[model samples]
Target: MPPEHNAGAEHMLVSMLRPLVERGHDVQVWLSRYGKAHRAYEYRGIQVVPLQARLDFGTAARRADVLLSHLECVPSTAALARGYGKPLVVVCHNTHRPSLRDVAAGQTALAVYNSLWMEREAELFFAEYPKAIRPAESLIVRPPVFAGEYATRPGKAVTLINCNREKGGRVLEQLARRMPDAQFLAVKGAYGEQILPALPNVEIVEHVDGAEMRERVYARTRVLLMPSSYESWGRAGVEALASGIPVVAHPTPGLTESLADGGIFVDRNDIDGYEAVLRRLLGSAAEYRLVSKRAKARSAELDPAAELAAWCDAIEQL
Candidate 1:
């Protein structure tokens, strides 16, 4: 686990593992590179272990029946699993350049994709490779959000989780200038700095832990904005929906799936269209109420227990 904090992948990992722990299944998280040394504590009954060196990988791998890995750790973990004769489960959290070496190695028993779009993307990326080189099994497991963790409040501002260019900082700047009457809250992210000029209406909030999202961000959010050019799955949109807040985002495949009827999808380049949609929602109480209801309804679709069961079933079969 490279990302120590403020990562959706890490948050989703914790959510999936917590239920397994409650069910009395021994679950442990081993961080390949430790950043938050002082913060290494048991989380929801699972011990967080930090590996000191590459040599420590074998010790940890030997203890686990199935090795689960994500992102940068996949290649090394895949190699280790091959050596240990353990089932390697690779979780695809985002769309990236598929490594031919890793996929062709035949070590991965399963590939767990976060979205159908991501799964399809992976299939396309590996289309040129021989069929035998691909992972034996592939499945879609949408990210889960605990609806009970969020609540509907009397919020009046439009919220954006991350303020980097990749997360649409330029769009935020344009929107802020175009819609001066609208209030926007931009939460800083780990990847990029805020380069947008200061605007009176847009308020920049410091990043908060995943546990504090409801209280710190969603509490004052009327609508969520996800103007990213690309996304495998938009976690912030679902988080907003859990709070009964509608999302206005670019019509990316992942966003379309996650937000569903709860979102008003506008084109990324259509600034005027974005403004028009926002105006309708903000200006009309009835429309906002309807969208809010839909948002909550959409949020209900993401059942953490169901997702955990799916993961458990996959692990059991593995």
Candidate 2:
């Protein structure tokens, strides 16, 4: 229900809901807090309504048949679903600390995890809670990506999507300094903006909408850098792979599963290792081409239509 920013979770929500609407499902998205000013709008035939208060939600729930809740809205949405005796489906976008309130709320809903690693973490987290507070059912649904949206092209620079400490902004700075000959492009993320003043070789790019990623970021990216401390699924890495650009990232559980053999995995703190792999890719055209081929092949496995169909099947059964 947050404004549809360039974040991966928001992108996934739009991609999934749009197709459902196209299939003749009368789907409406209700924002709990944000985007209240932009009260009503039609996006890809899906109606978005902003709920201002508890009363507004109660009124809306009376008209709705099922409740689909995101992470932040789980507590309130779960309470409403219970009150209305509706089936609640909670979509877990990331690995979050489970509070007693969240655990209690989860009991009344079916959980849909974005990745297998996330599902394992959620199960572990819920295991610490009382049995009565555990979710009724849980399922893993990898986030969908439109491979057609990206293109393979000649690239000249190494790109990092998000410039924040948690996202490996400092790692990018170090790499930029070590490889002065390599061009580094840092795309501004939703959080943190203090990266520009430190690194001279790294070019800072303003954040663009997800639809503009190919022309604005991937087209000029020889390799994608994802040095995040944690990742639920690594959406940017998947996007880069779709463009035939190899991702060099720390092997977080989500990134490891998403990239498979397509990525160049480096330890989170291994600056030397990252530099070695990147230098090899930049210096040898053959190596880059080989990795690009692997990247494309791996990306082909992600079929958006298939994923959407699976979602439809699951929702129908629910």
Candidate 3:
């Protein structure tokens, strides 16, 4: 699966829905897979439930005006929408089948692409396969990373949020070894096998929930190191920019589009390049300040106000 479908998708999904709730719309999230226990949880005014929760899906689907979902759950969620004749909004976080499967099948009434690249990928996919069902309408809403909630006084450690191989965990390890004197923070991701290095200068942090990310991680990060081999859109990188935190990242199309001029591009495999960039930031206050200013400016351009308003308006119109 793509890194975009990782926890970032969930965060982006919630960010999109939160606005609906604010605008007096009823919003609920049903967890597709969970332990056998019937349960429900809540976050930022959103009520989340397991499939067998007290408020069962059949009832929810039958009554729901519209269904919004993504990735692994899209298939079953799309089914509920079709069964109830409700509109389906599939948020595309990846170019892969799971994210676009329902969209391709024309099961989705409104398809929300998380990045321009992903939007194009879906377009190309449908164009290549003439028989596929196209979505009636489409829109691009990059993962909303609101600065107010995410911003904090930046701290010192060079941080990498997810330490999985595809997320450039190995690249982080190599960088850590090369720059022994520099401090590095390795954050264990909510999913995937973590490949953390046992280096003295590297402090390993346990996996954290989306709610805890602002305080527990970003507050302590000065630079976000995203060496991911594949990122549909690096939400974490944008989150860091909220606080004027510079990001050194691998040149993925998604990251390139989302971060824009905010990101310092580096080859993930080029440990030396990563080291040079990190060293320059550490050694030159002027360069760091310029990059930091650029990061903040970029974050402002991505303000969720207009994009979120459009998202809410579209969903509400349905």
Candidate 4:
């Protein structure tokens, strides 16, 4: 029950947790609990209890019946939860697990993947730990974007998210330089500071929550720029499309599937293809309108609340 550190994780947690609380299940969120940033509070009427860091096992065991954690950070939480005989649920997001070298060192942990690709990775990971517990198949849940408040795109700035610099910053910066006419907004903070300030045309804003993020990023956004190296279903792309904004990206793993034909993909380093696609979309009001319309229509099919309610039903059965 760690209060997740990232906005995407937070959104998913809120969506899933809210329903469970309404159904009368007690919920507690543990994190870097002693830190000032980690405050105990209520969210949507659910009481949030933040446990202090380095807390004793006896204290943690008294609190909950289950331990739900992210896949990558599973080892410590799983071990602790297992010691207390609590049911552990690992929400897997990545398609790859730690290398064989890490496994041989006795790191046996549970994982529940977001997609089949990640589930396959978990199988490979558990090959090294015969006793490793895997999260129930019923626990596998899709990452969700907040819906209902989608806005019509104003066909202005090319919205680029500088999530990970090693992943997409250089290309976005270069594109901003080339397409000087196109205004670029970097969903900025932490990692973004490295490149966002250097580009004069790029405006940087602190991270946004689900609903606000959808409205703000989609409101004035012309095209969504996602040049990611990898993703477990790029949430931003889903949000943009849900808001009737088109995305242009490189065909990275999860993103390729998530964006589908709702996006235009450039061949790796195919700057010309990228430029041409952008120009084509920007050139015609009619073409832009059609793409935006199709993007939202595609996103509507993956309804967050419906999917979340289904997930909650499965979890309650556990």
- Highest TM-score model number: 3
| TM-score of model 3 vs. true structure | 0.95
The CA lDDT of each predicted structure is: 0.80, 0.79, 0.86, 0.65
Local accuracy of candidate 1 as per-residue lDDT tens digits, 1-318: 323467778877777777778777888777876465545557667787765523465787887898888878888888889888999988888776754345546787888788878877777777755564778887777877887887658389987888888787888888889899999898887567764548899888886777788888999998888988988788888888887898999998999988888888998888898888888989999999999999888888776676678788888788
Greater-TM-score candidate between 3 and 4: 3
Ranking by lDDT: 3, 1, 2, 4
Report the error of model 2 at residue 296, Å.
Answer: 1.0
Q: Candidate 2 on 1-318: residue-level lDDT in tens?
A: 334456788777877787778778889887765543455777657787755423376787777777888857778877888888887877788887753346446445567788888777776766765554666776677888888887758488988887888888888888899888889998888656546535667788987777778898999899999988988899889888888898999989999999998998999699999999999999999999999999999898866677678777767666
Query: Each prediction's Cα RMSD?
Result: 2.4, 2.6, 2.6, 3.7
How high is each candidate's TM-score? 0.91, 0.90, 0.95, 0.83
Best by lDDT: 3
Candidate 1 ranges beyond 4 A from true positions: 1-4, 51-55, 99-104
Report the backbone clash tally of model 4.
Answer: 0
Q: What is the TM-score of candidate 4?
A: 0.83
State in Å the error of residue 301, model 3: 0.5
Q: Give the winner by TM-score: 1 or 4.
A: 1
Q: How would the candidate models be sorted by TM-score, starting from the highest?
A: 3, 1, 2, 4
Q: 2 or 4, which is superior by TM-score?
A: 2
In model 2, what is the error at residue 57, expressed in angstroms? 3.3
Runs in model 2 lying further than 4 Å from the true structure: 1-4, 35-37, 50-55, 99-107, 130-132, 197-200
lDDT, model 4:
0.65
Q: How far out, in Å, is residue 184 in model 4?
A: 0.9
- Deviation of model 2 at 43, angstroms: 3.1
